[model samples]
Target: MRRINGGGVIEETCPSWCAGDHQDDQATDLDDLAHSSTVTALQMRVNAAAPSPLLSAAILQSPYEDVTSERVTPRAPYVVFAPSDDDFTIELDADGLADVIAQIRQHADRLVQVRNQLMALRTGMKGTAAMSDGL
Candidate 1:
């Protein structure tokens, strides 16, 4: 497929989830030539005390080494995690993703423990308050 911005013909087959070529042909830098899949909202929170803002996940790919002589190594498609406001973005490969998954599970378990402790504390406080009212 031809790049819309006159970057030339794209040799790589588009991934099934890719939203199509959004890259600008006029972009002078290779990093600007990238393709992205449809964004998905992630059900996650950065802070437990505050309401979670929208987090998004999508597959992203820049021009591979085969397409550009500037790159030393072949570029691989990676998962991009970004916030709704696009303040920052994190790119991860398979191994990095695995580590993140493991850490998330561990943190989630810890959060559950904290929640249980908070519930118990609330119950104890309620009991003490009730006893004081009767006194």
Candidate 2:
């Protein structure tokens, strides 16, 4: 048998089966009704074209837009961008070029070190091979 509570349908065995030895448990009936409604709603949502509310919004945000720039010519002599006021028009001399290369190599080495430390903390550095000496 079914009865309406809070605009939801609650299912129960015949009242005769629940009388004398059993009485209507309002709490249990309400919980079952609520659970049934929730499951039905979730199933409907899953079958819909747009399941979760965030799915459509996330889809709309993709396909990044293009931006125009003044200085970034297709064929600039060097990758020229002044990061700060103190370092404008920094051209790559032999030493400066070497320094830049070494800085990049050092940054990569540091990343590996940090990754190794993280692995050690996370999984006791299990099966991690030692970094090669030759770069």
Candidate 3:
């Protein structure tokens, strides 16, 4: 694909999941020349609250390659997580992402346990109320 800023042809092939070219030709900085894949929307909610905000997940690749610098180098494509509100972003590699998934599973399991306990409490309250009505 062609770089918008007259950088010439892009040699790398787009990832399978990439929707389209996101390279900004008019980008004034190298950081803005990064390529991004189509974002996958993760509908996340806290405590079962309404109006769940969407979390955007995508794979990103840096624009430049084969540069030896103390501050930067050619980096492998990595996943980026961001909120729909565009507040902040977190980037992670495969192993880091796996850790995040594990943590989420642990939290989800805890939530399930709490839900079961709440259900039991409600059930017991219902039985007590029924007996009180007979009194």
Candidate 4:
């Protein structure tokens, strides 16, 4: 993506039949997405890169639904918790990690206070043991 007029621009080659000096009018409106930049650039890149033979074979072996449907859209400052056969991962953005750490520390402080209360109760019970032994 190249910056032009303080925003990103993606340029692509058009086929001769699709070419015109002022062909911006041929665009279809897709909501929220900048159609001229994002969608057309993706199509152009996919068309330009020929798939490897092994990749093509693997895609064929996979389910048909896998080819037609993909719903993952990634953004900055996100998390991905992925688990596999042998391993798992919990990936978080820097700010998210900081927030988690803060929450853990806050809970840890409460846990320490509860533990001290339990210890104090045990000490009070031990005084009864000392008195019984004296009697």
Which structure among the candidates has the greatest TM-score? Answer: 3
**All candidates' TM-scores?**
0.66, 0.27, 0.70, 0.35
Which pairs of residues have clashing backbones in candidate 1?
5-25
> On residues 1-135, what C-alpha lDDT tens digit does candidate 2 reach at each position?
344355554444432211122234343334332111111112124554654321010001101112242323211222222223233434333455467568768987999999998977766434333333333
lDDT of 3 at 108: 82
True lDDT of residue 19, candidate 3: 65
lDDT of 1: 0.67
Candidate 2 has an lDDT of: 0.35
Model 2 earns a TM-score of 0.27
- Which ranking of candidates, highest lDDT first? 1, 3, 4, 2
Provide C-alpha RMSD values for all models, in order.
4.7, 26.5, 4.0, 20.0
How big is the positional error of residue 110 in model 2, measured in Å on the Cα after superposition? 1.0
Candidate 3 global CA lDDT score: 0.67
Tens-digit lDDT track of model 3 for 1-135: 444354545445556765655544343433445567877776666786764546667887765634553323355677887756466877777887787778768988999999999999999999999999999
lDDT of each: 0.67, 0.35, 0.67, 0.39
User: RMSD in Å for candidate 3, one decimal?
Assistant: 4.0
Clash count of each predicted structure? 1, 0, 2, 0
Q: Residue 81 of candidate 3: its Cα lDDT?
A: 73
- Residue-wise C-alpha lDDT for candidate 1, range 55-80, written one tens digit per residue: 56687777543555342334678887
Worst 10-residue stretch by lDDT in candidate 3? 65-74
